[model samples]
Structures are given as C-alpha cells and as structure tokens.
Target: MGLASASLFRTCGAYVILAGRSEARLETARQRLGDAQTLAFDITDSEQVTEALSRLPEESLDCLVVTAARVTHGPFAEQPVAEVREMFEARFWGAYGLVRAALPYMRAGGAIVLFSGVLSRRPGMNCAGLGAACAAVEALTRGLALELGPRLRVNCIAPGMVRTELHDRVPEERREAMFRSTGESLPVGRIGAPEEIARAVLLAATNGYMTGHVLDVDGGHTIRQYATRQ
Candidate 1:
C-alpha cells in the first residue's frame, strides 16, 4: 500500500520519504525510488515516530498518510489474543500515535490520509476483530477531520480487497478462492490493484475540500456485500 502510493507520489514530482518497521524494505524502496529517502521506525512507537519526524529537513510537513494495516482472518472464537493485540497495535494505535506525534510537525493546509478497509462496514466470517479495527479507523478519521478542521484536513480511504502482500496471511485453503469469489462478487467483477487504490489516496491527500469523510474506493464491494448478507 505504502509502496504503491509512494511510487505514484514520487512519479508526480513529490519528494517522498518512506517510513516503515523494516530496514530491508525501506532500503529496497529507496533503491526502487532512486531519489527518495527512507526512514525506519515502528509506527506503534511514539518515540520512534517523533524521532523520525524530527529528522526531516522540512520545518513543516505538507501531508501525512497512514497506510499500514495487517489483519488475520479466522473465527473470532479461535483467534489468538497475541495476533489481535498485534492488529490493534499496528493498525489502530499505530495511526493514533503517529498522528499525535506528527501533528506537531505539520502546519495548517496539511492533510492526513488514513487507510480503512471494506470489512469495516462489510463483515465477513472470521473477521470480527479485523472489522472492528477498521471501523475504529473510520471513526477516528471522521473525528479528527472535525476536530482538526480549518487547520488540518483528515480523511480515510476504505479500499476493497487489493492484490497485495497482506493477503498472504489468508488461510491457504481460503486464499485462492477468496480472491476468485471477491472478484466475482464485486460489482466491478474484480479485486482491486494497489495502484488503483493509490489513485484515490492521492486524491484524498491533495483535495482541499474533502475532509471528515470515509471515501469508499471499494469497487462497490461494501454495498454489494451488504446486499448479499441481508
């Protein structure tokens, strides 16, 4: 997700800084991006995020985009407590902490683009906790949009299933069929690509009037899925 967005932003003449928990990944991104910089830090660590922001040469950041999320799909009754904790730490608390730390470095006219998932509003078996976490992001986006308005614009992009590394965690038995079924189920008749979602992320970040909104870039998945559930 971050890589796709970074590529788009970088291509369009934005000086990009890639941040993540993996030095290897960051190094790879720096090589791929050629001219961009990379910062290695755990978003869940407030101190680390603050230190990272401090290292930036710019006195004020123009945009902040939080696109990190990991979710495990399994029956709620069988879900491991550790994985659930990891999800909240990475997906929810990580965004919360980063924003709190990064806000100090961003001036008015700055914008925040958050990532949410279709499962937030379209529940599925074995995804209750994952859905809850995404739903929290949606709520947080709206709340921050309202509270930070006139200074900072906040919004979320709720994307449908995109072909990304995140899907490697889906149970092997379900993985292949899940994508097939999702492709057939969505009104667009296909799962999304990372670049497709990246386009929407760019819009949410650059658009001055869009705030406090959960823009659905789900290819009609949420609404179509909802209809099936009923």
Candidate 2:
C-alpha cells in the first residue's frame, strides 16, 4: 500500500521517501520510482525512526502518508497473544511513531494521510483486534487534526476490501466467497482496487481545504445497513 501511494505521489511530481522493513521490496519499488529515496527502518522502533528522520532535510516533507498495518483474523480464543500485539504495534503504534517523527518535518500546508479500514466501523466475528487498531487510527487522525490545526492537515482513508496481496492469505474458496458476498452486499457490486484507494489518498493529501476528515473509500460498504435479500 505504501508503494502504491508513493507511486501515485511521484507521478504527481512529489519527491517521495519510501520507508519500510523490507529492503528488497523497497528497492523494487525504488526502481519503479525513478529517483525517489528509500529508507529501511521499522516504524515501531523509536530510535530507528529518529535516525531515519535525521537523514532527511528538516521541513522537507510536503505530505506524509502512513499505510503500514497488519491484520490477523481468527476466533479471539484461538488467536495468539504475540500475533495480536504485532497487529497493535504495526497498525496503531507504528502509525503513532511515524506521526511523531514526521511532525517536525511537516510545515504549513503539508498534509498527513493515514489508512484505516471498514472493519473499524463494521467489525466481523474474527476481526476484533484489527477493528480496534483501525478505530484507534481514526481517533488519532481526528485528534492530530485538531492539535496540528490551521497549518497541517490530518485525514484518514478507510478502505473496503481492496484486491491486494494481503487478501491472498485467505483460502481460495473463502476468498472467492468473500468477493461474491461483497459484490452482493455492496451497492457498487465489487471489491475496490489498490489504485482506487491510492487516488483517494492523493485527494486527501492535495486538497488543502479538507482536514480532520475520515473519508471512506469503501464502495458504499459503510452505508449499506442491511444485507441484500435475494
């Protein structure tokens, strides 16, 4: 998701800095980015974040988008404690750390776009931890917008089940069923693509008038209150 967002921003003439734990994947993305900088750091580590930020010129960022997250789905009793903690660290704490580290580099008119999920509002049976993390992300976005007001804009993009490598983890039959269910349930009649969410993120970053907004790129998933009866 970060790579997709970075590609979108670079296409729009922004000099992006790619940061993540996977150096190989970052390099692959960098090759596509032409001249963009790549920084390998774990967002969960404060010292690493501080060190990485130190490498960048002060107040050099025009937009900071945090799309790092982890999702674990299973019955709560069956889920491992370590897995739950990892989700919190990746989805919630990592985002918080990035925001804290990037704040100084963001000047007036700059924007920060964070990613959440539809699960935050419409949680499922096996998504308790993910739901909580996403909810926290939305809350943090709102609070940051208020606290960082008038100069810097803070917003969140809550995406529906977008087709990505992340979804490949589900069993093939289950994945198909989920898609079919989403198509039947959502008014838009299909799952969204990564590019669709990327466009929304770009909009949030570029639209100077918008702030503290939780934009749902969820294909009306949030609006459909009742399942469609066939």
Candidate 3:
C-alpha cells in the first residue's frame, strides 16, 4: 500500500520519502520509484521516527500518507492474541506515530492521507481486530481534521479487498471464493488493485476541500451486506 502510494505520488510530480522496515523491499520500491528517497525505519518505534524526521527540513512535507498495516485471517477463537496485538501495533500505533512525527513538517494546505480497510464498515468473519483498527483510523482522520482545521487536511481511504501479496495468507479455497463472491457482489465486478487505492489517496491529498472524510475506494462493497441466497 505504501509502495503504491509512493509510486502514484511520484508519478503525479511529488517528491516522496519511502519508509519501511525491510531494506531489500524498500530498495526495490525505491528503484521502481525512479528517483525517490528511501528512509528505512519502524514506525512503531518513537525514537526511530524522531531520528528519521530529524533529517528532513522543517515545513518541507506537502503530504503524509500512512499505509502500513498487518492482517491475519482465521476464526476469532482460534486466532492467537499475540498476532492480534501485532495488528494493532502495525495498523493503529504505527500510523499514529507517523502522523505525530510528520505533523511538524506539514504546513498549511498540506494533507495527511491514512489507509483504512472496507472491513471497518463492512465486517467479515475473523477480521474483528483489523476492522476495529481501521475504524479507529477513520476516527483519527476526522478528529485530526477538526483539530488541524483550515490549514492541514486529514482524510482516510477505505479500500475493499485489493489483490496484494498480503492476501496470500488466506486459505486457497476461501481466497478463490472471496474473489468470485466479491466480483459478483461489487458493482465493479472485480477486486481493486493497489494502484487504484493509491489514486484515491492521491486525490484526497491534493483536493483542498476534502477533509474529515472517509473516502470509500471500495467497489461499493459497503453498500450491501454479504448474504447467501437460498
């Protein structure tokens, strides 16, 4: 998600600083981005975030997009507590830390775009933690929008099931069923790509009047509940 957002932003004439934990993946993403700068850091660590931002000039950032998250699939009772904690750290605290660090660098007219999943609004089995975290993301966006008011903009993009490597963890049968069902269920008849979600983020960041909004980049997935027909 971060990679997609960075690529889209760069293509749209923005200088992006890509940050992540894995050096190899970050390097690969940097190469794909052509000329963007890479800053490898774990967002969950405050010291790391502070150190990373210390290198940047004050008020130099035009936008900040937080797309880092972790997801796991399984029945709620069967899922491990530690894994659930990991998700919260990644999706919730990580984003919060990024926003905290980046806020100083963002001046008026600057924007912050955070990622939330469609499941925030449309719950699914075994996704309670993920859904809750995403819902918090939306709430944070709105709250920050109100607090930052008339200067910095804060918005969220809630995407439906996007085809990414992250989705590979789902059982094969369930994954296929998800694909088929989502295609039929959504108005667009297909799952979205990361690039599509990236586009929405770009739009939200650039558009001046679109603050405090949770833009659904989903294929209208939240409009109707998923129920089997008799």
Candidate 4:
C-alpha cells in the first residue's frame, strides 16, 4: 500500500522518497518507480525514525503519508497484553513518532496522511486489539489536525480489505476464498485495489480544505455492515 501511494505521487510529478525497514525491498520499489529516493528505517523505533527524518532538509518536506500497520487477531480475553502492545508499537507509536520527527522538515501548508482500517468503525469478532489500535489512530489524526491546524493539514484514510502483499502468507485457495466472500459481501461487489486507496490518499494530501477528517475508502463496507445490523 505504501509503495502504491509512493508510485502514485511519483506519477503525479512529486519527488518521492520510499522508506522502510528493508533496504533491498526499498531499492526494488525505487527501481520499479524508475527514479526515487529511499530511506531504510524501523518505524517502530523512535530513534530510527528521528534519524531517518533528520536526513531531509528542514522545511523541504511537503507531505507525509503513513500506510504501514501491524494487525493482531484474537478474542480480547485470550490475547496477551504483550502481543497487543507489539501491534500498537507498529500501528500507533510508529505513526506518532514519524509525525513528530517529520514536522520540522515539513513546510507550511503541508499535509500528513495516516491510515486506519474499516474495523475501527465496523466491529469484527476476534479483532479486539486491531479495532482498538485503529480507533486510536483515528483519534490521533483528529488531535494532530486540531493541534497543527491552519499551518498543516492532518487527515486519515481508513481503508477496507485491499489486494496487497499483506495476504501472501495465506494459502492461495484460502486467500482467494476470503477475497471472494468479502467482495460478494461489499456493496461494490469486489475487494479494493491498492491503487484505489492510493488515489484517495492523493486526494487527501492535495485537498487544502480537508483537515481533521477520517476518510473511509472502504468499498461500502461500513454502510453494508450498518445495514445488516438494521
């Protein structure tokens, strides 16, 4: 998803910098984009995030987009606190640290795009920690927008299930079946594509009037869930 967002920005003529924990993956993604800079850093580590952002010139950054997430699934009663903390470390603290580190580099009127998930609003069994973590991100988005307003815009995109490498661990048949079921359940009649989410991110970043907003790029998932409940 992050790669898709970076590619979209590059296509739109913005100078892009791809950052991740894997130097090899970042290089490969950079090559795929023809030409773009790369930064290798562990986002969950505050010192690493600070060091990475320090490389950028002060007031040179025009926008910051965060799409990385770590998902944990299990009943609340069964899940250990340590495992939940790990999820928060990746999904929540990572974004928090990135925003703090990147602020000095961001110019006036800059935008920050953060990602949550549909589960934050639409409940799912066995996703207690995931939902809570996503909700926390949404809260952070609102608080940051209010705190940094007029000078900088902060917003979030809550994406639904999308076709991304995150599902590679699942067996082919199982993954396909899950997608098929999910697609049929959604009002759009298909699962989302990474490019679809990327387009939404672009809109959020470029729309000067949008701030303190949580845009749901979730293929009618929330509406369908609400309707079924009704």
lDDT by candidate, in order shown: 0.86, 0.89, 0.86, 0.91
> Number of clashes in every candidate structure?
0, 0, 0, 0
**Model 2, span 1-230: residue lDDT tens:** 66788888888888889988889988998999889998888888889889989998888888999987888888999999899899999889999999988888887789999999998998878999888889999999999999998879999999998888888888999998988888678888888888889999999999989999999998888887586736
Clashes of 4: 0
Ranking by TM-score: 4, 2, 1, 3
Which candidate would rank higher by lDDT, 2 or 4? Answer: 4
Badly placed stretches (over 4 Å) of model 1 are 170-174, 225-230
Top candidate, metric TM-score: 4
**What digit string (tens of lDDT, one per residue) describes model 3 on residues 66-89?**
887887766788889899888889
Better of 3 and 4 by TM-score: 4
lDDT (Cα, 0-100) at 92 in candidate 4: 96
Range of the 10 consecutive residues with the lowest summed lDDT in candidate 2: 221-230
- Error (Å) of candidate 1 at residue 41 is 0.7
lDDT of 4 by residue, 1-230 (tens): 88899999998999999998999999899899988999899989888888888888899988999987788788889889899999999999999988988988999999999999999989888998898899999999999999999989999999988989989888999999999888878889889999999999999999999999999988899987433221
lDDT value, residue 173 of candidate 2: 96
Candidate 2 clashing pairs, residues 3+ apart or interchain: none
Error of 1 at 133 (Å): 0.7
Model 2: residues with Cα > 4 Å off, grouped in runs: 225-229
